[model samples]
Target: MTTLVTDTGHPVITAWSAVSPYGIGRDAYAAGLRERRGTVTGLGPEHGTTPDGVGCVVPGFGVREVLGKKGTRSMDRVTGLAVTAVGALLDDAERNRAVGTGEGAAFTLGTTTGSAQSMMDFTRDSLTGEQPFFVDPARFPNTVMNCAAGQSAIWYQLKGPNATIAGGRAAGLHALNYARRLLGSGRARTVLCGAAEEFSPARAWLEHRCLDGTDSADSAEGAVPPLGEGCAMLLVEPRAPEDAGQPVLAEILAVELGVVLDGADPRPALVTCLRSALHRAGATPADVAAVARSGAPGRAGGAETEAVHEVLGTAGPADLTPAPLIGDTGAAAAAFQAAALLAFAADRPQQAAGRIGVITSVDRTGSVGCALLRLR
Candidate 1:
């Protein structure tokens, strides 16, 4: 397992925001979680004939509508989600002050692919158009996987390092680990780290086909969970002495990542990640107050549950499963899982204060990871 933090002081997450299925912004998401509201809604004509005919999409969200039409004509759903989420994070006066735009601020985004629908649509247009070169130039940027990350940096004027990592459902953890390193290396004073995914007919059918082919009981009838779309971002910076007066949402103790080769049981790999993260954080299983499970459907879900049990015991920590309320959020799964941790802490401060919360993820793509956080 790779430990994300060492001698360097652990980075602190000061503020976070989300444009999720519950709706836009942090407050909406927190309220939805508190009410245990379900976000799944029937698929419209735009999504074609999905296997489930339903999805957990950001209600009434549109790129041009949410973000003004200025420079938004070519923006795709994923990019719009990411940009909106970053805007929400910076909207807070306190967070905005700490993360003022310039060379000192950076942006890192996690995604499976920038927007599968955009790429497919662009490709289809090229093939069906009168000529291959007749495609619209405005839409070409959406074909690349780094468009969202780059666009976010441009939109927010974040002049430091801008990168994108594609790690399926575990991408959020990967982005957080990257942000920690950036701070430790003094590459940026503040880093906006997060992940985004969009709901579309292309993604829905692709996921359905992949799950339908997997040899898991949950996929026996191709009854995979509905796809969900959204973005979640966190403001991460060094826990420096000058910021003593600022309230820290959580201290990121350790982020451990690992991989399991195909045909091997992922449970052992995830167990190792969880154990390593706790050890590096100088904490034990008994100190864990809650767990944010990935809640991935099918074989991966069962493996993740067993792995948590192996490390933290079957009844050790309270489970925070975001999938039930948000559906399958793909690349944004782990980010939403982190949000769930903070949301839980906010609702029950007395019970959550001074406790450790764990977030675990196991993706069918063979990625396994866990993060340990000291809730404050």
Candidate 2:
């Protein structure tokens, strides 16, 4: 198994922020997790057609309202979520200083696609417009998959390398791995890495159709959870003596990403990733205090559970699955999984410090990834 590790020492996550179903910002997410609150709300006509009548949307989130109306006339839900999350991370006084703007700071975002809704909408407009090529010019930019990454850099003035990674449910892990590379290569001093997913009529219908054709456990019974939308950002920087007095959330020990082709069972591949990440991190199963699983539905979910249990045992580590509370977040799943680990560790610093928190993701698209984070 190939391990994605950096020789530049373990990069630390000093700060993070989220615009999630729980609410906006870091405190709101922590509070919601502590309160065990559910964020699913009924979808009204404004949401257009949806597979289910409900979804976990960021409450009261609007592009124009959150970002102001000046340059957001064409912003879509996914871009709005990404920008809002970056803003939330910068809101922290300490994190803001750590992530100085201009050529030193980089921005990386993960997504299955930039905005499914925007792409579908633009295509529909082109096909049904007065002429074959007649469509809204302002909405064209939203159709590309890298729009969010570019917009984030432009909005925040992050002049370093900008990137967008796509890996379905494993996208966030992919982004994190890329960020580690950037830091190790001395390409950038700081990287804002995270993933964003949006809920929309187009996305909902697309997922419903895809799931309907699958033989997955929940989809077979038509009992899958509602879709969720949000973005989560982490301020990642290489370890330095200047960060001695600063707060450290978690240290990225290792990351491993792999794939299983030809419709084979996913368990073995995930097992390899888990074992590889732990080995690279110089940790044993006993050192893992908790695991944040992707909580994917159907065969993917079952395979993930079995792989983790096979490696760590069923009762060895605390299971932290965010899907039940946040719904299916698509590409943002693994990021929220990491956030859940951070939140769980925040309340148990004594037991968590120096312990490993493992994050595993298995997506139906044949992607499998695991990340080992040493809690701080």
TM-score per model over all chains:
0.95, 0.95
How does residue 177 of candidate 1 score in lDDT?
Answer: 95
Which segments of model 1 are wrong by more than 4 Å? 1-7, 97-100, 213-223
lDDT of 2 by residue, 1-376 (tens): 2222333588888888889998899888888877888888998887887866899999988899889999999999899999889988897765474564676688888899889999988999888989968987888999999999899889989988899999999999999999998888778878899999999998988887777334345442224668898999998888875656657889999999999897788999999999988889888999999998887777778788899999999886887788878888999999988888888889778878889999999887899999999998
Give the clash count for each candidate.
0, 0
Model 1 / residue 191 / CA error / Å: 0.4
lDDT of 1 by residue, 1-376 (tens): 2222232588888888899999999999999988999988997886677777999999989899999989999999999999999999888666564564676787889899889999999999989999998899999999899999999999989988898999999999999999888888777878899999999888988887786345336442223567899999988878865655666889999999999896577899999999889889999989998899888877778788889988999886878878888988999999999998998899888878889999999888899999998999
Q: Kindly report which residue stretches of model 2 are placed more than 4 angstroms away from their true locations once superposed.
A: 1-7, 94-100, 212-223
Cα deviation of 61, candidate 1, in Å: 0.3
lDDT score at residue 140, model 1, on the 0-100 scale: 95
Best-fitting candidate, scored by lDDT? 1
C-alpha RMSD between model 2 and the true structure? 3.4
